[model samples]
Target: MTTPTVAVGALGGTIASTSSSADGSEVVPTLTAELLVAAVPGLDEVAAVRAETLARLPSPSLDEPTILRTLQWAQAAVDEGATGVVVTQGTDTLEEAAYLLDLFWDRPEPLVVTGAMRSPAAAGADGPANLLTAVRCAAAEGSRERGVLVAFDDEVHQARWVAKTDSMSTSAFRSPVFGPIGRCVEAEVVYGVPADRIPPLKLLPGHAGGDPRVPLLATYLGDDGFIVDSIRADDVDGLVVAGFGAGHVSASMAEAIGRLARQVPVVFASRTGSGPTGRAMYGYPGSEIDLVARGAVGAGWLSPVKARLLLWALSLGGPVPRADVAAAFELRGRP
Candidate 1:
């Protein structure tokens, strides 16, 4: 019998954190990937684990560059004949990271991402359990072709639809549009929903080098359009507006957004956090339909964060026309 190899890429988050002092100790990302894998009791029984420390930072501190680096590491692991890969990081930005990975990772092997809410020093820390499940899922035959997954609290969430729903609970990640696609039960990976085979994003030749700047701004009540105007002064590549219910904004704000859209690609996503932005439902001045008429791209069901990442990637491809940007969103945002 041969054991499958699973590569573990460690990017420090709460799962790899520990208290630095006895009293008034502040936990930080201080553990290596090898240490995290070693802490799991039965990880060896699941697969031959190879560990690599990619970065050491709390997830909130992670930027687009770190994510691109992590994707490279995962591909390197797969090239080394590993059956799958596991990424351990902070839960704060796990959902966004996972979605980005899904967009770029075109391989068939499972790429599972997991994180911990409670630091290792805390009582009943869930890191070990989550790690164990992540490894098992990564190595499982069932995980292939499922796209990138966020495994936490025994649930397997598809990266495209998952969100960080809670702040401090072990069950922090959830896929609201479509519930988790699978689960890890007592070390066994179980598939509850059928796989939705969507093609990965077609990145340009030199995407990583472009470093396109896309800013995400959220709309609020009585926002006097100053912030929108303020962004005009800076050199920004694209913009994502997290607008109100069904992607509406104040009339003044809408006008400002329209002007910005003419300058750069402007994407509109719902601020309510769930559901897709309506394409042509409402016809009011500040409605999503109105915004689209003004040359803003509707984000469909994609959240603001995911929409920003997609827009950034599109911007990196160089001189992306509005139609190309809208088509990219349509390809990824559609069910």
Candidate 2:
């Protein structure tokens, strides 16, 4: 069989980080994509690896333009005959990045995103293993048409459902809603379930001109909606509210949300981290039903962060129609 060509793009994270001091106190991203690929044992036997250093900053510092550029690079690589693509970045924002890519990645070739919770300098570092697995997934035919995937700890998760659940565990990433779609065993890729693929969002002309600001607000006990009230319609392109238990907020917060929905798009998601936001469950003044009645949209199953990214992507061209925004959520927020 012909060897599959996989392009690996490195965005500095724990996988590429090393100690800045001799004492090894602070770890910073210092390794390039070529260096990371070279360090992985038996990687050359799997596929022909092409490496490129897209950025040297931590995942938190990676901006939208950089991600968009990476997307463009991946598309170009596929066009130039690469079988698959892999991205390495920090776990802190890896889920969000993979989701954002999934929203617009139209190609059938798999684009796998992976990262390490532990730095390469640390004992039991998992970068090389994760990288190898991610490459294996990318090179596998089973990964085709899966949209974007997150490969971590031998488990393969769909980008839409994967989340960074733990702060400092090698097995931090998880697909809370549907579990992993696949896994790597003995250097072989096995897929248990196929992920549902939503239609990719098309960018409008001149999408690169400006940045859309979409803020995510999490509601808590005794919250009075002061923060929601403070946001003016002109201040942001969209708003995502992480409400309590299946999307409920205080009465004051609901009122503020209602007011904001009249001016700008508002989406409410669950703060519990899993499951879909209630569509017609409660009917109180501050319930999901009330919020939807007030012109706010429910983010059925998308996490708050992912909801924020969706809203931002929708608003990138300009003001998105309320119906269009709702339609997007209807497709993406479902299981």
TM-score to native of every candidate shown: 0.97, 0.98
RMSD to the true structure for each prediction, in A, is: 1.4, 1.1
Best by lDDT: 2
**Alpha carbon lDDT of each predicted model:** 0.88, 0.92
Whole-model lDDT, model 1? 0.88
Candidate 2 clashing pairs? Answer: none
- Residue 274 alpha-carbon offset, candidate 2, angstroms: 0.9
Error of model 2, residue 324, in angstroms: 1.1
Model 2 clash tally?
0
Candidate 2 lDDT tens digits, 240-333? 9999999999999999999999999999999999998998779998899999999999999999999999999999988998999999999889
